[model samples]
Target: MQTFVTEAVDWPDTAPALRERVRALVAEHGERDQVRRANSWTKPDPQFSRKLGKAGLLGMTWPKEYGGHERSQLERYVAIEELLAAGAPVGAHWIADRQSGPLLLRLGNEELKRRWVPAIARGEAFACIGLSEPGSGSDLASVRTAARRDGDGWVLDGQKVWTTGAHVSHFMIALVRTEAGSERQKGLSQLVVPMDTPGVTVKPIVDLTGAHEFNEVFFDQVRLPGSALLGTEGEGWKQATAELSLERSGPERYLSSMVLFLELVRHASVHRNPELDMLVGRLAAEAWTLRLMSASVAAKLARGEDPALEATMVKDLGNSYEQAIPQLVQAAVDFGSPDNEVLRAVCFYLLQVSPSFSLRGGTREIVKGIIARGLGLR
Candidate 1:
C-alpha cells in the first residue's frame, strides 16, 4: 500500500460560508416531503439528483479539471451531513456521488476521469458499487465474477447479489476476478459494467421491510472495451480496500439512524422523563463523537491518504451505534410513557430497517476483521 501523509491542510477559513451555501441549496431544492415520508433507502427521484449536480454539490471535492468544484473534503462532508440529517433522498446518486466518482478520480485512467467525472458531477449519469456477491457478503475479494481478456477487451460472466440500485443505475463499478482461483486476495480486477449492456441482467431483491432497495445482478458473456478497467487489471483487492475506506467512513454511517433519533427526540421533548432526557444526552454525545471521527477521516481523504485502519474503526463503532438506536428507542418507549403513534411507527420502521445498516457498505464482522489486521492482531 502506498502511504500518503496527511498534514493539516488549512481548514477553510469561512467554513460557515460553505455550510450556508449548501444549506441554502438544500432549502431550495432538497426533497423534504418525500424524504420525510420515505427514507432514502427507497427509490430516489432522478431529477432531484440532477439538480444536485447542477448545483455543483455532487462531486464537490474533486479537481476542477474533472468537473468537480475542487472544494475541500470537509466542505463536502458538511454538505453530506446536512443532506443526511434532513433525510434527503440522495439515494439515487448516493453511491456514485460519494464513492464511485472519488474512486474513479483517484484510480481511474485519464480517459475515464475525463469521461465519467463530468457526467457524474452533472448528475446526468448515475452509478453504484458492485462489491457484494451472492455468497461473499463483505469479503469482496471472495467474489466469483470473472472477467477474461478477449481480443482487445474483456468478457465478463457472474452474478452479483445485494447490489444497491442496480435496477436504476446506469453503470456498476464491479469487482471481478481477472485470474482464476488465486489465493485469498489476489488477481481481482475492478471493471465498469454498463447496466444497459447486452448480457447484463438485474433482478431486484425485496427486503424484509418490503423495500426493493437491492438487486441480484447477472453478467453473462458481457463484453466491454479495455476502457472498462478502472485501474490495473490485477490490482482489485488493493483498489477496493482503498476505495471502501472512503465509503465506510462518512456521515452516512451515523445518519442512517438520524430519522428515528429525531422522532424520538420530538416525542421525548414533550413527554419529558428523566430517563428520556439521559438517553437523548447520551445519543447526542455519541453522534458528536462519530462526527469528529468521520471528519478526521475526511481530512485524511482530502490529503489523498487512505486511512484504512481509521476508517474501519469508524465503521465498526458507527454500526454498533446505529444498530443500538432502535433497541434503545424501544427501551425508552417501553419503560416510562405511553407510545405516541407517530413515534411508534417511526421506531417500527427503523427497527425493521436496522439489520441492513450493518450489512451495507461493509458488515460489522468484516470491519472488525480489518481493524484487527490493521492493529497487527490478525
Candidate 2:
C-alpha cells in the first residue's frame, strides 16, 4: 500500500526578497533588443543566460564548492518561478541547472563534477539530455545508443531526436546501452559527451514555431574516455529515471503558456467581456492549483525524496493547462483586430505550438500510466 500526500509547505519568508530580485532581472532583459520574447525560457539566448548566471540565479541549490550560491531549494524554485513567469530566455542554462548539474552532483565522479559543474553554475556552459532516440520516445529503456568499451575508453553509435537545445549545448548527458547482449533497462549508462567529438553530427529540427530549437543528433563511431561515464556502468537506468523525475516536475511544464495567459488577464482588466472574464477566471484557478501541486513537489525534491508519481501527476495536469490556454484564448478573444497586439501575438504563437505541449516532457498517456502504477493500479 502507498499513500501520496502533497501537503502545503510554507514557503520561506525570504521568498519575497528573492522574487523581487528575479523580477528586476527579468524586467531588465525584457527591455533589451532581440530579447523581448513570448516564451522566453524555451528559446536559447546565451547572452541572457550569462546575465542570469552572473546574477547568481543559475544554480541556487548547488553548494558553494561548485561555484554556486549555496542557497536553499525553495529559493531556487522561487527564482525559477519568476523566470518562467517572465518568460526569461533560460533555455541555455535550463537543462544544466534543472537536472544536468544536479545529476553530476549526485552521481558524477570528482573529475566530472570539477570539469563541468563550475561552468554550468556560471552559465558559461550548456547541457542537454540524450534520452530520446529516433525510435524511442518516452520509452527511455529502449534506447539503442551503444557505448562499447574500447580499452581505456569507449565507442558510441546511435541517434537521438527531439533533443531541445542540442545544437547550442556544449555537452549532453546521454543515456546509452553499455552492456552487450543486454536488453531494456539492464545495461544502460549515463555518459558525459562533448558535442565537438568526432563522428558526432547535429541536425536541427524546425518545430511548428518555426524555430530551430529541437535537434536530431547522430553518433557514428564516436570515441570517448572511460571517465565519461557519469556513474557506475549498468546503473544508468536508475540514474536516468531519477533525472526524468526532475524534468517532469518543474515550473516550465505549467508555465509554457503563462505569458499568453497573463496577457489575456491583462487584456481582460482593460477590455472585459463576460465570456472572456469567465474563461480567464477558470484558467487562473487551474494555474493556481497546478502551482501549489508543483511547489509541493519542489519541496519534496529539496528533501531528496523520489516523487516520480507525484511529478508525473503535476506534469500531466500542468501540461493540459498549457495546451488549453491558446485554444481557450483563441475562442474567447476577437482575433480580427485585438485590443492588445502584444497579447494577441503571444496568444497566437502559443496556440501554434501548444499542441506539442503534451508531447514535450512526457505524453499525457505515459504520465497517466505512471500515476496508475503509483496507486498500484497498473
Q: Highest TM-score among the candidates is held by which one? A: 2
**Residue range 219-301, candidate 1, lDDT tens digits:** 98999989999988789988887777778888788777777788889888888899999999999899988888878888887
Q: Write the per-residue lDDT of candidate 2 for residues 1-378, one digit (tens) a residue.
A: 435585877798999999999989888774332223555667888988888889899888888999889888899999998888887778888999999999999889898999899899888899988989988987878899899999999999999999999999999999999998899999999999999999999999998767888899999999999899998899999888877899897888888888788778888898868998899889989988899999999999889898888899889988888888888888888878746677777777877777888888778888888898788895
Alpha carbon deviation, residue 117, candidate 1 (Å): 1.3
Tell me, by lDDT, which candidate is best: 2
- The window of 10 residues in a row where model 2 has the poorest summed lDDT is 30-39
Global lDDT of model 1:
0.80
lDDT of each model, Cα atoms only? Answer: 0.80, 0.86
Each model's TM-score, in the order given?
A: 0.91, 0.96
Candidate 2 residue spans exceeding 4 A from truth: 1-4, 31-36, 338-340
* TM accuracy, model 2: 0.96
Task: Return the clash pairs for model 2, or none.
Answer: none
